[model samples]
Target: MIKLPSAFRTLLGWLPALAVLVFAGMALAQSFQTQIYDPTTRKWVDYTPRAAAKFYNRHGQSPEEFRRQVVPFRTAEKPGTIIIDGDRHFLYLVQPNFQAIRYGIGVGRDGFGWAGIVKIGRMQEWPTWTPPPEMIARDPESAKWANGMPGGPDNPLGARAMYLYVGNKDSIYRIHGTNQPWTIGLNISSGCIRLNNEDVSDLYSRVEVGAKVIVLMQGAALYKGV
Candidate 1:
C-alpha cells in the first residue's frame, strides 16, 4: 500500500464525521417534512394544510414562533397536568423534571375570560358543533346550526376538543383546535382555549381523559422559564 500524504489522511479521518453529519441532516429534514398526526382522519399530516396555509397567507401570518415546543418551565403542577395562562396566551403540559410542553393558544374574549380548575371530562375527534341555547340567543345566525354542525375542516372546533368539567358538571368551556390559526396568541374565543389544529391533535394524543386543567386569570403567576 502506498503511504498517504498527511493532508489526505486528515481528510480521510474527517470523512466519517462528515458522513455522520450528512445523515443527521437528512433525518432532521424528514422529521421536519412530516409534522404530526391528524386525529380527525387518523392519518399523519403536514404542518399546514391548504386551507390553513391560505388563511394564514391571507392574514400575513408566520406560524414559526408560535409552534409548540418543549421548554423548561417552573410549575408546581404534576407531570400530567395542563395549565393555561390566559393572559400569556400559552398552555403548558407539565412534564417531569420541571419542564413542560408549551403551545400558543387563543383565549376567551375580554368579557368571556375565566379562571378555574377543571378536569377534561371527555374528548372528541372531529367533534360536532352544537350551538347551545344561550349561544343561539346571543348570535341568531347560529340558529342554522341549532341541531348540530357535523365536524369538518370548516368546523369551529378544528380537529379535536377536550370538554372541561367541574365535578361532573359541564363547564361548557373547551380546550380545542381552531380553524382560524391567526387568532392564536390573542384573546378572541368565546371562552374556549384554542390551539392550532396540529397542535391540538398532538396534545390530544398526549393527554388522557380526566387530566387536570387549570386556567389562570389575570393575577395568576405565570410559568417562568427554567
Candidate 2:
C-alpha cells in the first residue's frame, strides 16, 4: 500500500482533473477562417464574389456553342436536364420542355452516392465551408466548426454555393463553386456536385433557387482537363 503524505495526496488528487483540462484545451485549440491564396495574381483575394472582383478574363461565350458544347438543352427531348451516369460524372441542367445544359462535374465517392431531382434551393457568394460533423469526423485536422464556416477563399465551398433541396428537405448535396478550375469535369467530391468558380458563376446567373437539377447516369462522360 502506498501511504500518501497530506500535501502529496492533495496534488495527486488533482491529477485527474488536470488531465481533463489538458484534453479540453487541445480540442478547443482548433481554429478556422476563410483564407485566400491567389496563385495567378500573387495576392490573396477575399472569397466573397463581388461586382468589383473579376475572377478571370470574361471572353465571349457564343450562345450556340454554350448551348451546344456546354449544355445541349435537349433540342426536342426531355423537359428537364439530367445529371446522368454519376459513375461517369456529369451534370445536366434541363430547360423547361426543351433542351438540356450539360456540364461535367465531380461526384461523391462510393458510399456518399446521391440521385434524383432537386432544385437550386439557395445561392451564396464566397460561401464558407463549415464541414458537416460527419466530414469533420472523417478528417479532424480540417477547419472545424459546429455552426457554419464563413465565406472566403480558404473555404472549401469556394466562390459560390448552390444548395440542393427537395421541397423543404435538405439532401445535403450541393452544386457549388470550386477553386480547382481543372477539376470542372473530373470525379472528386463526396456527394456534392462541383463546378469551376467561373462556370459556377455563369450557372448561378442562369439558374435560380427553384430551377431543376437532375443528377442522372450518362452513357458517355468525357471532358477536357486543364
Candidate 3:
C-alpha cells in the first residue's frame, strides 16, 4: 500500500471545509440579488433595494401577484375592453383570441365597491388629487388638501389616472396609480380602482379615451357580448 504525504493529506482534509465556505459565500451573494418581471417588456428586470422586495414578499401578496401575464380569460366583451373584477382583485384587459392581460389591482374596501359601465372620459398624467367634500368631512386631516394636492411620487395617485364618466358626467371614480404599491391585491380603496405605478402607466398607454370600462360588483353578471 502506498502512503500519502502528510502535507497532501492535510490539504485534502481541509478541502471539505473550503468547499462549504465557497458555497456559503455564493449563497450570500445571491441573497442580495433580486429581480421582478416587467410585464410591459415581457422580461425580468432587476429590482433595486433588496430590503424592500424582501419586506413586500414577506408581508402579503406573493411576488407573482404583481406580474402582468397573458391569461386565458373567456369574456364575452370584445377586444379593447376593460373588465374589472373587484371581488377577485383582478383587472383584465381583453385581448384577441379569448385571452387577456390580467393585472392585480387594489379595489375599494367593503361597502365601497361599485358596479357599472362607464367610459374613459379623460386621462391625466400625474394628476392632482382633491378630496371631495364628503371625504374631507370624514378625514379632517385631508382638509389641508381641500384646494388640491400636486402630483408626485408622494401623491396618492402615483403616475397616471383614467377618469371614468357616465354619458359626459364625471362618475368621480378613477382607475389610477397608487403610491403604496403594497396595497395592490388588497381591499383598501375608497371606491376607486388602484394599480401599481408601472401597471397604471401601462394601462393608461393602452386604453384610449372613450374606452369602455365595466366594473363588476358582487353577484354581477359577467360581460356577455357588447
Name the top TM-score candidate.
3
| 84-134: candidate 2 lDDT, tens digit per residue | 446544556566755556655555543344446666678888886777676
TM-score for candidate 1, please give it: 0.69
Candidate achieving the largest lDDT: 1
Whole-model lDDT per candidate: 0.75, 0.55, 0.75
Which regions of candidate 2 deviate over 4 angstroms? 1-68, 71-85, 95-99, 218-226
Task: Predict model 3's lDDT versus the native.
Answer: 0.75
| Models sorted by lDDT, best on top | 1, 3, 2
Model 3, range 73-189, lDDT digits (tens) per residue? 887888889999776678999999999998888776544556678888999999999988978999999999999999999889889999987777676679999888877666577
Model 1, 1-226: lDDT tens per residue?
Answer: 9999999998796675445334432332111121435567998664444634554686566355467989899878789899987766789999999999999887765456666678999999999999878789999999999999999998999999999877775666799987787777666677789998999999999999889998876632221110
Better of 1 and 3 by lDDT: 1
The residue-level lDDT of candidate 2 at 104 comes to: 52
- How many clashes does the backbone of model 1 have? 0
